[model samples]
Target: MSRARSDPDRKLRKAKGRTASSARWLERQLNDPYVKQAKADGYRSRAAYKLIELDERFGVLKRASRVVDLGIAPGGWSQVVRKLRPKAAIVGIDLLETEPIEGVTIFQMDFMADEAPAALSQALDGDPDLVLSDMAANTVGHKQTDHLRTMGLVEAAAWFAIETLAPGGAFVAKVLAGGTDADLLGLLKKHFRAVKHAKPPASRKGSSEWYVVAQDFKGRE
Candidate 1:
């Protein structure tokens, strides 16, 4: 494994009235080995390692011809795709602005919009072999509300994958720790030959995020 971040010896000077949560987050970012590795590897965010780790276990990127990325801000996932599958037709959409990634078609549009699916499909020029979503809703501090909101994004992403993925394609999305809800799990099971959950080592141990991988699409009826 690559070297761990510098011993956590560096300290941030206390700022006036900084919240404990913010301070802890800052410290974690500074000391995270993945953050340092990402910088060395020229990845835009540490989240890149999460994708790398997942791909290692799940073989999500190999031989993909057309791919769609939802919630692609910071564009690390797209970067991984570009490097691993250089010839793959790649399109990504996000609500926030993402700087241009060479060879990736990006739209600064909401993936939840009615026109988003059609736009993505038209851009790719063919059914996607891999549909990826890393979207999570903004938290409002209430656990139930937060879960519901994020899961809603997951559900929407699942529907898009079901409708757009080519036969024998795959869908992968970020989900919370309890894994996908019953209804969503049922939908994926009906369409894919394998459905599994994975939590990569790059994910923080305390983080509730887990990923659901649905593979071998059965094609639309």
Candidate 2:
């Protein structure tokens, strides 16, 4: 693990008008060992470790697997997937452009568009072994609004997974932990043998973000 280094400019700025929240955020970022370690490891974001930790626990990555990554901008999670499954076929899409990375094909487009999933499926050429979504809508500051927006994205991603996943495949997606809607959970339980929520250590302590892991996908058209 790398030690955290102080930024003189940041310290000076903090001294000028440090609100409690700002100070806490700065302190957390500076003292976070994972943040330092991620920088040293060349990951695009600390969120990369969240995927790594989840994969370690779940054994999701496999050799030559076909994988789909939704909202993969910044490319941290996609990078981890490529590193773990070097020969796997990966197709990543996001509303924002991501710099190209070897061994993965990235598409820049809004996934909510009518043609996006079809385009993604065409790129894959067959049902995927895994579908991973790290998508979160831009927050509007209202907790209820944010939750609804995020849930919408999750629902859409789940629908796509249902259409494009092979039997016995997996779907992993980010969701808020207030509790998933019973309707959605019931739908997932119907199609997957196991559905559980996970919070990897790399996620910030105060964030509501958690991942839903659905395994043993039943092929349902």
Candidate 3:
């Protein structure tokens, strides 16, 4: 395990145009150990550590041969997948443009589009053994609305995984801190042998994000 160095907390001077919120965010980033470790480890964002921790606990990547990455902007999660499973076929989609990563087929489009799932499945050429979603809807500053939108994306991703995953495949997705809603949980329980939720240490203590891991797909019979 990489440890955070004992550096002093960095405080940025209040600039002419920086808002208080932005300044606080900047300071938080400056002081975050995971952020610093991500830079040193050549990962794209601190989020890479969250996936690493989750995988360490769940072994989600160990046996994956083909993978789909949803919400792959900045390409951090896919980068981890590439490094951990060098031979796995990887396909990723995001509304935001992502710089190309070797061994990853990226499509800069909304995952909710009617044709998006087919495109991902076609690119992989077979059912994926692992599906990862780090997607979150753009917050409209309303907590309830934000949660609903994000959960909707999660539900869509779950359906994609259910529809296309190979038997015994795994699905991992980001959810709100209260965890997967009742309907989604019931859906996963119906199709997977195991369903669990985890909040990795790399996630900020103040953040309301959690991850749901569903494995051992029962297949679409």
Among all candidates shown, the one with the greatest lDDT: 3
lDDT (10s digit) by residue, model 2, range 133-194 = 99999999998998999999999999999888999999999999765677788888899998
Worst 10 residues of 2 by lDDT: 5-14
Clash pairs, model 2 backbone = none
Q: How close is candidate 2 to the true structure, as a TM-score?
A: 0.89
* TM-score for all models, in order of appearance: 0.96, 0.89, 0.98
| Candidate numbers, best lDDT first, in rank order | 3, 1, 2
Which ranges in model 3 have alpha carbons more than 4 Å from their true place? 6-8
Model 3 C-alpha lDDT per residue in residues 67-150, reported as the tens digit of each score: 999999999999999999999999999999999999999999999999999999999999999999999999999999999999
Give me the runs in candidate 1 sitting further than 4 Å from their true place.
1-3
CA shift of 144, model 1, Å:
0.6
For each candidate in turn, give its C-alpha RMSD to the true structure in angstroms.
Answer: 1.2, 3.1, 0.9
lDDT of 1 by residue, 109-142 (tens): 9888999999999999999999999999999999
Better model by lDDT: candidate 2 vs candidate 3: 3
State candidate 1's TM-score.
0.96
